[model samples]
Target: MKRIGAFLLTGAFLLMNVAVMAQCSLCTKTAQQLGEGPAKGLNNGILMLALTPLVIIGFLAFRWWKSNKEA
Candidate 1:
């Protein structure tokens, strides 16, 4: 039991270290090369990519509710 607990703790610590140590590469590049037409495209793409999942999830949730209500 103690071995399993130690293994889990090690995994958690490694994951935390990786999360904190990594830099946002896209953000760094964007900061370096500010104010250009392609940057605007990148910003717009990120916004659309972020919103796409929300829109899809919302649609699926509404469909799920509607189908469950009729049953």
Candidate 2:
């Protein structure tokens, strides 16, 4: 039951679609001037930068959970 609930929650999170504006006012203006290609590049760059810390934290949390489960 617990495992099923966890899987369902994870599945729900994975299925969720959300748009994030990872741009500041200055960045938005810069992208607008630079055009679509640069705008996409800027957005991807920002997302990658933001994702690094999250990846690390998620990894740490998974490891902690696994260790606790073993105990």
On TM-score, the candidate that comes out on top is: 2
Per-model CA lDDT versus the true structure: 0.70, 0.92
Clashes of each: 0, 0
Which lDDT value does model 2 have at 2? 98
TM-score: model 1 vs. ground truth: 0.49
Please write out the lDDT profile of model 2 over residues 1-71, one tens digit for every residue.
Answer: 99999999989988988766799999999999999888989988999999999999999999999999999
Instruction: Give the lowest summed-lDDT range of ten residues in model 1.
Output: 14-23
Output the TM-score of candidate 2: 0.70
Off by over 4 Å in 1: 1-34
- Per-model TM-score versus the true fold: 0.49, 0.70
Q: Which stretches of candidate 2 lie over 4 Å from their true place?
A: 1-19
Query: How many Å off is the CA of 6 in candidate 2?
Result: 4.3
